[model samples]
Target chain A: MQVYVDGIGILGPGFAGWPASRAVLAGEAPWPGGETEEPSAAILPPNERRRSSALVRWAMHVAEEAIRHADHDPRALATVFASSGGETGVLDQICRSLASPERVLSPTLFHHSVHNAAAGYWGIATGAQHSSTSLSCYDSSFGSGLLEAAAYAEVEQAPVLLVAYDLPPPPSLFPARPLTAGFAVALVLCDRPSRRNLARLKFHLEDVLRDAPDTLADPGIEALRGGNPAARALPLLTAIARRRSSGVRLDYFEEQCLSIEVSPCPP
Target chain B: MVAMTGKIMAPLWISHYTVVTALGRGLDSTFAALRARRSGLRPCDFEDAGLNTYIGRVEGLEDLPITGAELMPFDCRNNRLALLGLRQDGFEEAARAAARRYGAGRIAVILGTSTSGINETEHAYRDRDQDSGVLPAAFLTRYRYTHNTFSLAHFVRSYLGLRGPAAVISTACSSSAKVFASAARFLASGLCDAAIVGGVDSLCLTTLYGFSALDLSSAGPCCPWDEARDGLSLGEAAGFALLERIARTTDSGAVALYGYGESCDGYHMSHPHPEGLGAILAMRGALARAGIKPEAIDYINLHGTATPTNDRVEDLAVNSVFGTATPCSSTKGWTGHTLGAAGITEAVIALLCLTHGFLPETLNTTRPDPALAIRVLIENQERPLGRVLSNIFGFGGNNCSLIFGGL
Candidate 1:
């Protein structure tokens, strides 16, 4: 499927926003490895911000940034939020409570445990009534979500926002799925090019047996990409940052990977 | 309110479908239960859950572990239920045949679930060492296979030997229902020719205790639209449907997906919009997409979760869109609310209603709340049905409505 990217939002350990991340991804800046910055979640009402989890905050932050960058009406466009392990920290807490003697779970935590919590919060904060879907594909969640978003844009001939995020699980559950850092990336994609278009992407699924996915050349970014599933978008993001045409393959399924042709559309 | 363009979409043929609920293992048993007006709900006796609420638990899962070395890693109540559902009514053979006809890479597997195999993790957490808080070594397999949301699609795709595009939609109760819309778009975009769309959600402690924490668990069989309706009776179910592009001049008796609409309440997380504004949008959007008026719909399968607030809001929504004239009923009384699987389970029920000419009434709901306005059927209606709409609203205010009609 083909779609034009209008805006980008990214956050990671060393990166903060699209502008800074673009420099790092383009090899023009040093990778300042550190803790991920806490999100303000300014777009959310105060009460919701207080009640929101880290994952929701991270997702909402990027979504807000991308929508602002694209200058699109948040209430008008559809959204797709993808995460490999959604609210793993909250799940861990719930499981621990269930394992305890009292087994008393808080209502807030219980409501926030659903996989679509971020999408829900995004809806509540932005009042976006358009169709929103939350999905997961283990390590390939980003690729899966991108394809879905692109498909929706192409079929509906409308703009769609794709947000992919993942955070490491709590210590007890971390060993099973060892994610190192929190990462999120959001892209506003439309079927047709606009003045805000940053790149055009043509992505399709391919048999993994034919070739392996592309890898990052920088060691630090490569390590980050290997550590977190959402960071798998680094290669494509790099292509966009360089303002050049390139192709990158992303891990999608056990037998299939996504091959994407990225052509920058700089204004 | 979002603008409605009312552009009709091409329908997709539901070539094959099957479901496994507490009603029984196959469509025959399910249809029989509906015909006999019998419910599958029983007293909550699942494992060590001490909650004093009714449940619609699928029996025999304890002895139905997923077999074979390739699938042994996915041995959990959820996947076992999925396998059970796939084995019913020749769905596996039909899916495999479609895979061959379209090529394995040309068919996609899209399924839905709220908590996929969290039951395994709950057990693992219970078995963890107290000192180090370390889970058992065996949990690695469970986490990678059973606990993962994508595990459902992975298991189904691998079991059927299909290597096409696959993903697990986890939008809570609206999960499975949205799979239809996604599958249709994927097919339209030339990503796949045919698709396997379904959902599987098994009973787990998280949902049980979680709902209980919110005081949304009914102590008796769920009674939708009842004046005294209190809370919902949770159930586990798995349902699958094979969707192929409709061919020219299809059989008149065939059931096809005519339209699907998805929207978010953007109001609350657990509670629905007070006036069911989101529900109304979804229903209207669906009707617009199907290119049919409200009167064209003969039967309405309500998402009456039996929760007082939910039923009341849905009542308002239905009345506003289709008015009080359309015959509407909630099937939760028969199979309890299956959460993520509710969409597909109710969808399969709607397809059955289209094929069997049976419009099931709202079971266990005797006294309809007079405050509500929609026509709530408390007794079975046996009439030839053409088009049916099924509603599924979930946490995050996620709402989806699907239209199934005889082509």
Candidate 2:
């Protein structure tokens, strides 16, 4: 089944939102190389804002952006939040507490340490009682999430929101799975083409294995893609930004790749 | 069965299923334990968190060997339980046969886990070097395969030697239950011919103490629906099922996944909606997807965590949907609340009821909560069952209900 992308939200180091990142992806502007601070999620209530972690903030930021961009009711869409490792900052704190003599874990931190904490916060903030799923698949998290969201949209025949995000682990975990930067990408997908659709994505899971990575015109953007699994969406995002019909291959598993043939819908 | 308003999903056959939990390994022991109404929860003795609570910990995991040499990097309590579960009831052999029949590339692995090998990280932090503030080299080497949330699915895919699309859903306690929905989607989307769906969550200091910190851990074995129920008893478990399209299955009496529903409470992070609004949506959605009415359900494996809030809210939800006629019980009293693994654990139990024509009681509950309107079974009863609904709710208001029935 073909899935249409109605909206896109991109956040990463030096790239803030879809409007600014579109220029960078299209090579219309130079790649801005700098550290980007975490979003505060000012849209959330004060109580929720105080409890929100960087992961929640990033996830909510992109979710709101995508829903708003689509001009869709947040409550109407099902959601899939994908992350490689969830709330590593909270993980580190809990680990440290458990390792200490006191073993006094913070109640708030413990509650928020769950893998679906971001999805929970999003539901509360938006009063969206629709179905929400949080998932991960190592380096293939983005691809896995995309497939899940697309498949759900197809089966439910409804617009589904897909959010893929990953934040770097603490310094202690750096040597093992080194993630240089945090990134998040969101796509609002529908089963059928609609007026809000930015592009039509024909997604297919091919049995053929492909190890070659898509090259970016700028080495820096490629670095960003390599640095984080979520940033792997950069190639497809770039294709959409350019409004060009192109095929983007995403690494899915050891022996298969998710091949998407993108055809931009005319406004 | 009464007709429903939503689309009826094609049934997926449950070819093989297994469970490894405190009730003992494999289906036989778990079923026997359930028949005897035995409680696997013991006083909390896991790694000295010093909390007054009960835990349902799988025995002998410390001695269970990791599946293979390449799997050493994934060695941890969670993965060990996963491997243990895979080896039980000849599940590994069955999975291998399916892989051969369908071709490895057409089989997908979707597992649920909340804390995948986080215990190893906790140990690493405790043993960190005082001088350089660095963790042990061994910990770092296995961090990617051990601690990452996706490691469970990655390990399972590698161990089983199947290469279809894989994912790790981690929506807390409802994690594994949602995998059935995802697998159905994958099969419906023609992404895979068959899917291995399950969940594995192991006992860790993080969960034990974390639940304790939240004051949600029970001092004694949990008693779901009991008038005096206080809190939940944390437990660890691993459960798996091989799902295939019913059209391709030749078995005459294969149990099939009839329907599933998922929803978020959007009410509270740690607490449930007092009215069980999300639970109602999930249960109703499941029936709608199955094209059946609430009265058609013979049994319900409730997401009864034994906490006052959880049990009370679930009672309301069940009462709201199925009324007081559906025989309902919470098996958590036998295995404790397995969290992420609870979904599959209960799913396997629901399947067992269909196979054995028995109804499992809510173990350890002395009396059903009189305030609740739903019927809460307190003893095992023999009855022929055709359709069963299993409920799994999680933190962050994630709720999922699944319908399983004989073809």
Candidate 3:
């Protein structure tokens, strides 16, 4: 059975998501259910004054977008947050302290630095009872996460939420050609079957594409804006979220090994 | 593309163990802590810190820098954990031998980390406001995001001297667990004769404040399965497992990866489905893959983070499958949730259990959740067991389960 990406939210370099991603998906109709626009960059809720890392802020926005897009109540869904680099902003702070013998890794960045932090934030924000998972597949992050999530949905016969986001690394440390700054993504997956859904995912051991520009895509809005792998869920989710209620289908793929087929229903 | 597909060619082997956590620097100290049931839980102690929270801290990486420091440059705390973890469980030997056989090119080193080297990179940034075309003469490159994690692979590759398919699996909590599956797939597919797969995550401020902001960090030691379990006590650890072709082992240890299953629930952004559906799929997948019946398993090593949601859902998942009768335990109590390191650390423990034929206790369960259908081993038990199961459930609804059986 192929899993359909029921709902999605992709936050990129700019934009709160729904509208931006919808345009990219080339949707046939306006977002079926209409969209809610929020302050794009705020980390915590509008009422909450907590300062958050760039990653957390981006994650929060995407998470909210994904929850709403899925048409599922915030309290009802499960989630998975994947990142090759989790909250790079916070990590940079700790590294600074390491250089000084007197300064030490801050206790806050220390704990938030774990891969599970994003999920922790989402769990808390929504007061959701769903289990949250986090993953890092390096260059293959987008592909690995998609395959794993799809596999779970197939076996478990339940909806699975998968999010993959990565912030561009700050300078003065390691050097890389890609500048992956200010990007984040969020996803909601359920086991419900829909006929008008996108393509379903299939897994295989394919050779690494040595020549491909990039192997994996972030599933967040940033990926959609940048046009990447995990971000593919954006257009599909955008199409579904717009619909007041209808069976729609879309497919999310990576490394060509696995594909998640999402089919969202009318609310 | 696996070379051999019939009858699942061979079982996965677990040949090494290395741990660096708040409990202690190496495997021995961790074992000691476990036996004494000494919790590594401690309040956030960094006074110069940005956030206040509890964490399981690993001491002494500052003056320690890197041994064979000449080969690796740009000291990131991440690499330090690697060096420390490798020193334990006689892991260095396995790493050294791989280097010799694979010419440092054929042997690949895979790492699982939630946050790779962001700490070091951040340190350099605080020293400078801009990247001036020229790097500090003494400073090392490769600390960049594109390179740091990958470089760490090479750093370890050069450290242990392994020469094949060196890469990092940054799949958050599932990072390390995925390493095992990748290594197994590679070996069975004839990609490599031997591979080192594990996770290394160090405590950093970002995680602390980040988790704190989420309101998930426990003010006290994490209580897995305990009714009062509030949240997790963050810890840093580097764990490695030397996986070889199943047929290559001559040792007395019967620890081998019998089966593995992984899945993602696209349910929401952060929470796991209340039913533990993804988790159940993973566990079921592993059992099927290993060709072992659920009842045949003697012990289960859970990915219990002691979080309010994870505990309850995991309990339901266990009950749905194994029924509360099976012996199971969450070791997070002894070793704070090591995040990326949790998978491999738990893998090593799973291997150890199969060898010792004993089920360890869940450290801080004051009272097992009444809803739990499986026997949550509150106290360590000695018993002969042929098969053991290890479960790692991560943030993306990313769940992976591996069942290990005797040789």
Candidate 4:
């Protein structure tokens, strides 16, 4: 189905919020290229240069920018916030509270503990009256949310805000990092448009086997990390925000095989 | 007539339900206890969990083993319910046989869960720190590995040696119910030969207090559809079924997903529209998709959380859609609210009605809701039903309705 991305946002290490969205535009982030867990400079809130868990930091920064970019008047568009690792740190904290006397769960932490908290908070802040969702999948978290958003757009014919991000594996809980650092990407999908026009986006679902011999090829990469990783939305958002058409295909094959196609519109 | 392309042949036999609830373990246990119609309400003695309300706790998850560090985490409440569900009615063996016959890699494992393994993460994190600024080394890695999504996909795949696409749908309470639509899409698109779609969500701190925060929890066992219907009784469960294309052989037959309607209410986050407009839209959509008349529905297993607003709104929608004569009831009184798993659990219950020809009673209701305007099955009765509908509406205005049929 064809849907227009009216807005976009980004947040994470190396940069913060919309400013951090530059990584996607440049198509590169300079790093030591090793296991030395250094977060990229494209993420938001420049203060956190050396810290880990950039995913959480980035997700928060990017979401706010998304609302602003869409000029999102929370009174309208729906939302879908996705994360593969949902509040890993919070889960760690709650488990800690369980074994103690006078189990006092933090009200602030608890409020954000639910999977939909990010979406909920976004809604609450923006005064958006539309429904919101929090989703987790086997890496396809973004794809699933996008498909659902696409369905929402096709069926309900309304604009939707989609966010995908992952915090650094809580070092206190689990550890899988280095290139796996945190980042977030957002887009506003609607049937209508408002802008210094960008390309119209169409999505198609394709299934590619994990063991497919050519999975390492371009087509496979398009089917694997191209369509909807939330983070991968960065490439599309950056390209569009910079007023460049240059097509890009994303592939996220783990949960489901899906691809997003972008073709520029004539001004 | 050229039927909907994805629509498979009708099934002659109905499926059976084997529920695992705090009301004692198996279906025989549930059914036997159900015969007497007793409520299994007991105090929740969570490991220092402060909430004092009662829960429909399923025993045995505590002793269940985790594959890695107590920190690395293994089968948690989510997986426990899955194992419990697989144990009932040779579900595992039956699923195994179906996989073997169809070829092992084709039976997709599609599950719906909330707070998948946070119970483990919650426990691990607390032990590592008290006033610490940084968490312990062990918990950070393990909690991230298990809870949200990956562990669930891996856990199910490893346990059954399942080789198909492993997916975990976490949409809060709507998770399981929505799986029906997803499975149908996959089957229709020929993505998989068959699928075993269901939901498994257990009681956890996130849900328990989340509901409490909204003041949606009733201190006593919930009274769904009753005038005194207070709130939801938190519970845990797992329910799944074998889904395949229509084959000529009249074995278990095909219980294909005939139709599903999904819509966002665009209403409130925590509450359903008082008019049930979204609920009506969903029901109507499913009916239209299935090409069936509203009056064709023999019974409806209502989402029926027993909250004042939900029961009232759902009642209005039921009356408007099927009129006041459609037989319906809320099984939540018997099973408590299983959240994400409720959709599949109730779907299994509805399927059993078609197989057994018996409409299960809405166990305890001294007085029906004065606000309710539909015909509710207060007592058990056996009736011929060609089709049935299961309704599920979750937080955030997510609305879904599923239709199943008997040949």
Candidate whose TM-score is highest: 1
State the number of backbone clashes in model 3. Answer: 113
Best by DockQ: 1
> Per-residue lDDT of B1-407 in model 2, one digit per residue for the tens?
11222578998899999999999999999999989888899998888668899999899998986855788888888999999999999999999999999899889899999898999999999999987879999999888888899999998998988888899999999999999999999999888999999999999998898888888888999998999899999899999999998776366667999999999898898999999999999998899899998888999999999888998899988988888888999998889899889899999999999989989999999888888888888889998898999999999999999999998
B1-407 in candidate 4: lDDT tens per residue? 01111222232122333556766665566655555677665566655545656667777877865455442255567777777777788777877776787665665666777678776655554555556645556545554345656566556566676665556666667777877665554554444667777877877776676666566777777778888877877888877776766654544533545677655565445667778876886787678767788888888989888888888999999899899998998888877888878888788777667666767777666689776889887888886778899999876567678888864
Minimal lDDT window, size 10, model 1 chain B: B1-10
What is the CA-based DockQ of model 1? 0.69
Q: What TM-score results for chain B in every one of the models?
A: 0.99, 0.97, 0.90, 0.89
lDDT for B28 in candidate 1 is 97
Per-residue lDDT tens digits of candidate 1, residues B1-407? 98753467899999889999999988999999999999999999999899999999999999998988889998999999999999999999999999888899889899999999899889888999999899988996469798988889989998999878889999999999999999999888888889999999999999999999999999999999999999999999999999999864667688899998889999999999999999998999899889999999999999999898999999989988898899999999999899999999999999989999989999998899998899989999899998999999999999999999998
Backbone clashes, candidate 4: 39
Model 2 chain B weakest lDDT span, ten residues long:
B1-10
| Full ranking by DockQ | 1, 2, 4, 3
Better of 1 and 3 by TM-score: 1
Error of 4 at A159 (Å): 8.5
* DockQ-derived CAPRI band for the predicted complex in model 1: medium
- Could you give the CAPRI-style class of model 2? medium
Instruction: Provide the global lDDT of candidate 1 against the true structure.
Output: 0.90
lDDT of each: 0.90, 0.89, 0.62, 0.63
lDDT digits (tens) for residues A40-141 of candidate 3? 544355543264555666667777776666676755554556565565565555656554555444555555555566665665455554334455545445
